[model samples]
Each structure stands twice: as C-alpha cells, then as structure tokens.
Target: MTSTPLPSPTSTSGSTHRSPARARHLLSKVPEVTVWFWLVKVLCTTVGESFADWVDARLGVGLVATALVFTAVTAVVLAVQMGLRSYRPAAYWLTVVVLSITGTLYTDILTDERGVPLAVSTAVFAALLAVVFGAWWARERTLSIHSITTTPREAFYWLAVLVTFALGTAVGDGTLELTGWAPGTAVLLPAGLIVAVAAAWRLGLNPVLAFWAAYVLTRPLGANIGDWLASSRAEQGLGLGTALTSGLFLVAILAVVAYLTVTRVDAPGAVDEPGTR
Candidate 1:
C-alpha cells in the first residue's frame, strides 16, 4: 500500500481553520480512515449493543439509570479525548465504546420505557442526525473526518457520531419490529446495504457521504450481529449470551487497538484509503 504524509495540522483551508483560539494546531483528533478503522468500529458497535444489554439485565439497573451512568462516563471520556492534542487508540476507542453504549441506551429508553413506537423513534433520530449534520457542515464547511483538526470540528464530529449510533440502533431494532425477522435473518439486510454503499463509494460516490452512510449502517449491522450471537437457539441465535459476546468482542477490540497503537499503522498519514494499503 502506498502512504502519503499526513497534511499539516492546520493545512486544511476553511473558515474554521482561521480562528485565533485554534492557532496552536492540533494533530488530527481522529485516526486515518482504513480497513482497520472500520473493523474496530463494527466491533465497538457490537460491544455497544451487547455490553449495554448485559449491564442492564444482569445488574437490574433501570434503563434510565443505566443511561445516566453511561452518559456521565461518556462526558468524562470525551473530555479526556478532547484534551489530547492527537489521537490515542486507547482513549479514542474507549470514548467510542462508551458513546456507543450511551447512544444505544438513549434509543432503548425511548422505545422500551417511554412506549414510543419504533417507527417514531427512527424518524426522530433520523431528523436529529440531519440537524446535527446541517449544523456541522454550515459551521465547518466540511464534514470530512480527516479534517477534524479544530476543537469545534471535533465537537461536531463526536456529536454526529453519537447521533449515528442512536439512529442506527433505532433503525436496526425498528427493522426487526416491523419485519418480525429473527435476529439472524435481520443481519442480512444491513450487511447487504453496507456492501452496496462500499461499491458506490469505489464507483465515484462521495467519500464523505459514503463514509457516513456506512457508519450509520454499521450500527444496525453490529447490533444485529450481537443479537444473533447472544440470543438463545430458540431465538435463532448461538446462545452465547450477551455477557459472553460482549467479552469476546471487547477482547477483539483491545487486541486490534493495541496492534494499531504499537505499529501506528492506522495512525494519521499511515494509509489514506483502504485499497491503497
């Protein structure tokens, strides 16, 4: 794979880049987009679904309480992440894992506790995501993850990410509700759609659009996968249990993150595109 040196931290041209407060440039707060990036992302999303469920069911904490706990954790983790001048795999992925759980919990709260219909939850989150993207693009003039060098851009990026997770959860669970498909069967749709998106991306669809589309689809894909693994055989799952599934995926994520950290292969400037590397 060919490698390109990462652009200067403040090299990106934009109105947001001119801020005096941002004069001291920061390294890109996000990792370079690569295959490893996507793999760990799906893994984290799976953990988000399984781990959140395990904690809720095993601890007997009410859903709202669980959401509150994770919300608090997310704030602390994100603060730590934001304080760093560059990406640390451990800190960045930790923030993502926590954000995933919190976002999933948010959707679950609306659906299960508030008695909101799945379709309504889906629509609401979709609209919310659009609003976030609209605001982000209007302010930053770019939604490309690679350009997240400023504090405001990073803030907007994380906000969009949280919405994507919540939106994905609602869309995933909602699909199951509306289709009445078993957990295993429900996984196929998102998987197929993701492949389609990837193909479109390689065929000249915008990379930013492609990335976010795949990102949102991954939530459902990962969640359904977690459901398939944890569900009982009667539920057309492997019966691994949510606890076991979460443990296995968490280990997988740790292994991958450690590799990325040590090798710095997914670090900024390592690889620009998947096929190139």
Candidate 2:
C-alpha cells in the first residue's frame, strides 16, 4: 500500500482553522475569567443565599416551595441564555443569579427540609459534580471553561455550575454545623482556601484545575459572607435582615455587570482563557 504524506502544521487545505469571527463566536457565550468575574460571582453567591432566605421567610412558602419558584425562574433565564448567539451581560448574569439561588435552595432542601445529613448532601453533590465533569470530559476531552462555545458545552458547563453551588453550600454549612464555629470566623476558611488556590494557579498549577478549585471555594466564601451579613447579632452576623443583605449584594452585582457591559471588559478577547463557568 502506498503511504500518504500528512500536511504540515501550516497547511490550510489539510485541515481547518477557525476564522477570527468564528473564534469570537465560540468564545461569545462565556465571559472571560478575570478578577471582575470572581468578584461578581461571589456577589451572586451572596445574593443567592440572602435572597432565598428572604423569600421563604417573608412569603411563608417554606423551603421546598421557595426552591421551586427559583427553579422556575432559573429555567426561564437559562432558556434565554441558551437562545442567545452572543453574550448579553444582563441575560448571562441573570442565569447565574437564578442558578445560584436555585442551587442554594436545593442544598437547603436536602439538609433542612428532608433531614438529610449535610455530610451526605455534600458527598452527593460532590459526586454528582464529579459525574458531570467526568461525562463532560469524556465527550469533549476538556474541562476548560474558555471553550464554552457550543450548546452541549454550555449545558455541561451549567450543570457543573449548579452542582458546584450545591456542593459548596453543603460543605460550607456542614463545616459550620460540625465545628460550631461562628459565622464571622467561618468566612475566613473558604476565603483563605481560595487565596491558596489562586496562589497555586499563579505558581504553575493547571489553570483549568485551579480555576475550578477557586470556583468551588467562592461558593462557600460568598455563602459565609451572606450568613455573616444576614444572621442576627446573637448569631454573630451583622444583624442585617435578609432583605437588606440581598438587596446590597444584588445592587453590587448589577453595578459590576453594568460596568462590564459598557466596557466589554468580560468579552471573549478581553483576556486570556479566564472564563469561570
């Protein structure tokens, strides 16, 4: 049999290269990973914790019912996100906000509503997140969030995100329950952990791995912040009502998103491979 010679790396006809526009297109759905991204994410997580509590307590809808309401809202926003060809700051962050609330509610449902052990819920969510990542990698061969260009990738991305939020909630609250630590002191744990992860990433750790590690840590960090803000003085929190805490974080998130929208600072070409989800 005759042997066929392979084309060189520079050969255009031998393979395909994404056009600049196509490259932009593929990167359009997800925001760049940046300090701003992390700031806004933590804000979202904080809002998720406080807002869910406010709704349930104020409406008297109970945990499960409150979760269901956020679930519906998340579904609607996620649909809108999936429909967009390019990133719209409002739509994209709205999805995250909803997912954050829904995911927190999910963990609460297991631990508070169903009497499930926080350890069990933590393990379950961790396992589920692992499965999602495993399947996503098995098919796509990459877990990097920067490549969230296609519908399937976006789906996997969102699934992983939801599970991470749930897992973070479980682990964070579980630690609090086990240690009986005050919320004030508890916030330091996750915050310190994230700083370590960031340091590792800077010190040559795999960016994707570091990114995800930090992403998971942010959940607890933000949750703790929310708890510290919303809990009463007796509970070692700031005594801010859930409504006030939620509003504060929500406004902060909006301000950041607006800045990003106007500056396109989180756009695809804004930075190198910096997408969080």
Candidate 3:
C-alpha cells in the first residue's frame, strides 16, 4: 500500500490522556480501612490523655497553663498540616495528637476548674458534637473520611474530631463516677463494648454507623488505657507515671508516623480522573 499518512498525533495524545486518567482514578481511591489506621488512632488518644496529665499534674503547669501551651502548639502544627497538598502521615498524626491533648484539657477545665458536673459537660459537648455532625452532613452530604478531598471537608473533619475527644473524656469520667470503678476495672467496659461493636460490624452492621460508633468508643478506651498505665499501683495501675506514659506513646507515634510518611501509606485525595466525576 502507498505509504499511509502517519496517524495524527491527536490519536496518540488521546491514548496517553486516557491512560493517565485511569491511573489517577486508581490513585484517588481512598485508603483501605486498615488495622494500622485504628491502631494509630488509639495510640494518639492515649497520648492525649497521658500528655495532658503529665503537663498539668507532674509538671505543675496547672490546667489553664497547660491548655494554653497545647493550644498554641496545636495551632502551629495544624497550620503546617493544612499547608500540605497531599496526605502526610507524620504531619496529620502530629496534628491529631496535639488536638487530642487540647480537646481533653478543654473538657478537664470545664469539669475540674469551673466545677461543671460531668453530666452537664457531657450533655453540652454531646449537643456541640451533634451540631458539628449536622452541619458537616448538611454541607458535604457525607461524613465519611473516605471522601475527604476538599478543604471544607477537612475543616469539618477536624471540628468533629475535637468535639469527639471532648465528649469522650466527659463520657469516660462520667461513667467512672456512676460506676465507682477503679481505672483498671473501668477500662474493661469501653474495651468490651468496642470489641462488641467490631464483632457486630464484621457481622453485617452498617459500615458508616459502625465506623462512627467505634470512633467515639476509642477515645474512652485509649483514655482508660493511658490512665491504667500511668496511675499508681494503689489506684490499680502499673505505676508508669504520666510522664513515662506520655513519652512512651509519643515515641511510638513518632516511629509509626515516620514509617507512614516515608511509605506514603495513608495519603488521600490524589488527582481525580476525567470520567471519574
């Protein structure tokens, strides 16, 4: 045959475009709901409770001063977190740890310093969390972290996170008051409840409902664990001390975050494909 005109470059360009679009579509898929995610999340909450105690009780910083310090630090870390264009586990987790400590302290101040009853604090924070969830769902139509792609969604996510920590602290302490159980004994209830929730989830419970329920439960679980680790043997704990507990958990968090950052293990929201929308 006569030399066929070279196919127009547009054809080759279209093929290239299609390939990249597919690749991006795959990349945009949210991370798998992994064990590592839950593990690290629990660790962060543990650090939050223990770190706040260490600063306030052991260091004699006082609750207000400690709260101020953690708030300032959280603000700085959160700024760095927001500046990242993609997921960075180290930055993200660091921000979370700080937020956890700060949120716990906020509840403590309301309960301890101002003499607010745990029940009242619980009710107030519960209402606040409800408001956050309502606004978040109203605006984004989804509260699932799996779909967090935009800045507004991320803002809502963090807001909900802060409220959850505060609410969890209230609920945990409230339960202790009601049950009059030692910290070690108190740990079992939340821990057992969480296990039950996980079992239920595996047995066909709704994923979103299970996820949020577990998320709320984890705060108290981690808090109880931290308290058990740090309290004196007289209090039914291991006598780790708040400082040791905080340092131990913080180091573990750092190691895990470093690994995740290097491996890009939990980054989210990559470029979307043309047809994916």
- Highest-TM-score candidate: 1
Model 2 Cα lDDT, one tens digit per residue, 1-277: 1111111011121123232342324445877666777888899999888898888899798999888888888888888898888888888888888898899999999988899999999999989999998998776667766666667778888999899999999989998999999888999999898888777766767666787888888898999999999999999889998999999999998998888888887775565432222
Between prediction 1 and prediction 3, the one with superior TM-score is 1
Q: What is candidate 1's lDDT per residue for 1-277, written digit by digit as tens?
A: 4334321112234324343464446787788776788889999999999999999997798999999999999999999999999989999999999999999999999999999998999899999999998997777677777777778888888999999999999999989988999999999999999889888866877667788889999999999999999999998899999999999999999999998888888887676444322
Candidate 3 residues 1-277, lDDT tens each? Answer: 1111110101122122222122222222233345556778899999989988877876586788888988899779877876666666777778888888999999999998999999999999999988998997776566666555556656777888888899989999899889988888988998898888878866867656677777778899899999999999998899999889998999988887776666654444232222212
- On the 0 to 100 scale, the lDDT of residue 12 in model 3 is 21
- What's the candidate order when arranged by decreasing TM-score? 1, 2, 3
> Per-prediction TM-score, please?
0.92, 0.88, 0.83
**Collision pairs in model 2:** 32-274, 33-274, 33-275
Poorly placed runs, candidate 1 (over 4 Å) = 1-24, 272-277
Q: Tell me the TM-score of model 3.
A: 0.83
Candidate structures ordered by lDDT, highest first: 1, 2, 3
**Number of clashes recorded per candidate:** 0, 3, 0
Where does the lowest 10-residue lDDT sum fall in candidate 2?
A: 1-10
lDDT of each prediction vs. the true structure?
0.85, 0.80, 0.74
